[model samples]
Target: MNVPKASEKECIILTISGRVQGIGYRRSAQQKAESLGLTGWVANLENGDVRMVAEGTPDQVDALELWCRNSGPRMARIDRVEVVRQQASGVFVGFVIR
Candidate 1:
């Protein structure tokens, strides 16, 4: 993980749908988060959507969201990536696939 140089980290919550479930979306998200040095968890919802919480530099968060727009596991046909800015929880130690 590429640790940020400062403590002023940011956070964002993301909701994604369209072929997100049962397509390794969560795992792909976890990988992306880890590669970006973000701490968070990605999980599949019962509604066939995917949700994740990522915390890191603002630019990294933005990059992750952008990647979610259409990039992930090869089988994931991501249709959209909804982003919500929130206060950092400072709870996650590393990215996990849930």
Candidate 2:
């Protein structure tokens, strides 16, 4: 069985769609998350979406979400951002682009 060793309450999984791929979204998200002291990864989905999982304080997570909603990299046009809250696994060390 796979289980988290520690339960971090502030964690989020984001599915951001629309003009998010091939436009530095993953890298920019990584930088933003890292700067916010978040731990997790951002990657491009095969279906032209961007997926991000981040673990941090509620404020940090909110900040990241706000960034995604309002100000992604200049080139990206964000259409829909779906946010899912989950218990953090405390498994990541730093933010990265997957």
Candidate 3:
């Protein structure tokens, strides 16, 4: 995936779908984001989807998306991922699983 050039601080909302619930998707995401020096939160939506908001440079955010697609924990089966660029909300200090 081509990484877009973003400002020094920016946020992107990503909606992930597939067999992502009841697995370690949220935790894995949190860990990965933290490792990548990103600030965000990931949660499992009631509709069997995973939602994440990651703030960082475009490269880091894009890298997280790439990792989530294939390296999501052992039980996750990610089918599709939808990402939307957005302004940073500055609500989180670290990556969290919510």
User: Which number leads on TM-score?
Assistant: 2
- Per-residue lDDT of 1-98 in model 1, one digit per residue for the tens? 77554367778999998888877778778888998889988888888889999898898899999899968888888777788987677778889887
TM-scores, all models, native as reference: 0.88, 0.90, 0.86
By TM-score, is 2 or 3 better?
Answer: 2
Report lDDT (Cα) of residue 17, candidate 2. Answer: 93
What is candidate 3's lDDT per residue for 1-85, written digit by digit as tens? 8533444567978899999998888988898999998898999999999999999887788899898777888888889999888
Q: In candidate 2, what residue range of length 10 has the lowest lDDT sum?
A: 1-10
In candidate 3, which residue ranges exceed 4 Å CA deviation?
1-7
Ranking by TM-score: 2, 1, 3
Residue lDDT tens for model 2, 1-98? 65334454478999999999888889899999989888999988899999999998787899999999999889999999999998788888888888
TM-score of 1: 0.88
lDDT values for all models: 0.85, 0.88, 0.85
Ranking by lDDT: 2, 3, 1
Residue 32 C-alpha lDDT in model 2:
94
